[model samples]
Target: MDCGKRHGTKYFTVSSAENFKECMETCAAIVPCHSVDYQARTKKCYLGSHHNNPLIIASSFDSAHSVGCAGACGGGGCCKDARKDDVQEPAPLPDTSCGNAGFEFAFFPNDITYLGPNDGNFNPVVMKRTQPYYKGTTTRIGVTDAHIIYGQTPQNWEFVAVNHRGYLYAHQDGEYSFTAPIADNLSLLWLGPNAYSGYTRANANLEAAYTPVDSAPLEYKATLVKGKYYPIRFSWDNSGGAGYYELKIKAPDGTTIVDGTTTVSPYLVKFGCREAYGARQYAPWGEEN
Candidate 1:
């Protein structure tokens, strides 16, 4: 077997009929086989059946002299450059009127999970899944303002919202506000600490409504016990077809507490001592909380 294309992949140059067939089969087995170059003058095979081909004697070839001229120098035939240029670098970004820092508080596990290779510069905190508040269908993530970024429900992972200008904007709602600056795009995420305690529903005017929107028509009220151990309880004045409500809670330290769908009843309670610890663990959907 003769290897063709130095620094190039392997290719077969068949000298006989049987060898040509073998070479063709061998090349086919390879993942990416280069094209076969057959020498009509020599009647030799390369990557295919070259047997029974008419052999050309020096007398039969008009280009024989030119071919001979090249061989005379002992350099064989002309060689082509095989090296490729390096990959191009990305263009520099334009200077932004916005600074490099920003902040936002939101539900954990936002759209972009992996920070590419910029985790260090971004200082992303990991968000965990936890229990849902109700039993059958009322499941949601809650974001609370009281929890610290590094506390038990710490906001180690950060994300921010952006305005039409593509700069970061603070998530502003009545009674729910945090201080964080804007940079380029809002690539940070702020997850809710507890499903019930994190975010509160609002009226049309954005007034604080303790119950979630889904709980509205159903008349569900979720009560939270705030102290050393915070436990959120839930009950429905009117029951919807939904059998349960799902609740998820995050501690200041990024620990997650989740209650999957549970039966609507007198109360649904989750305990947390410092908003840093004692949050419920996340659970899968349809499972008992």
Candidate 2:
């Protein structure tokens, strides 16, 4: 496609939309966006201002369809979902090693009454009050962890979402499978490149709509190389009811890691720096940082 054929004012672009409909709505929100180009192969939306023109859109591809970005959400409704995505420079995820231990947790409490509606996220209205809920690392992703973060009694972790971000260290190459066996109100997870800057609720995986609770463990698997690191993130929300969540994992060799109170698997770990951990490199074990 002659991306630069039609020249005009080129504004900024973003690749956050994970679905066809989302890609459409994102462009509709921008006043100057003339059209949108979605790549099914990449599962990402590339949309920016053409000022009714174009400038070298992106990489070469087989086929493309020129269409308007008007979709279901309607511009006004999509604009209210500020918690959906934000325009900001992406922060780098630092390197990781076997020496590292535990995950870093952050809390976004969306409980302010005047904040209008509960968009299921900590929007800008309450963004200033965000805090570090937990500092230490835990061996298991047990259901009880919610209470520890909220300082509430058992079976009463409410009005908060626990976000854990770190690297999924693949010590040995194999198919890494993940599943949410059971969850109270809500649970979501993300892995690989999109888990970083382009993350949104639309891109999250492993929910319970397709499978029943504890009946069949529907697993989402990713073939990973040993010694390499993949950006990882999983969130557990319990604003509507008492909370309970268990993220079970299966290593390549079929060794399962379940996040129950009595079990502790040495899988999840945190790297010290907050730089570019998304570079896809092997672990520098026994090597200096």
Tell me, by lDDT, which candidate is best.
Answer: 2
State the lDDT of candidate 2 residue by residue for 202-232, as single tens digits: 7766553222255666568889776456777
Identify the runs in model 1 with alpha carbons over 4 angstroms from their true place: 1-227, 237-240, 261-289
* lDDT by residue (tens digit), candidate 1, 1-289: 1212111112344443223233334445544443333333464434422222212211211111111122332343221111122112211221122221111122232233323232222222212132222222222222232132212232222332110001111112112111111112112222233332322221111111123333322112222222212223221111111111223333233333232222221111222211222333333322222
lDDT of 1: 0.24
TM-score of 1: 0.15
Q: Which candidate number would show the highest TM-score if scored against the true structure? A: 2
Overall local distance difference test of candidate 2:
0.50
State every prediction's TM-score relative to the real structure.
Answer: 0.15, 0.50
Superposition TM-score, candidate 2 onto the true structure? 0.50
RMSD of each: 25.1, 17.5
Reference-based lDDT, residue 91, model 1: 16
Reference-based lDDT, each prediction: 0.24, 0.50
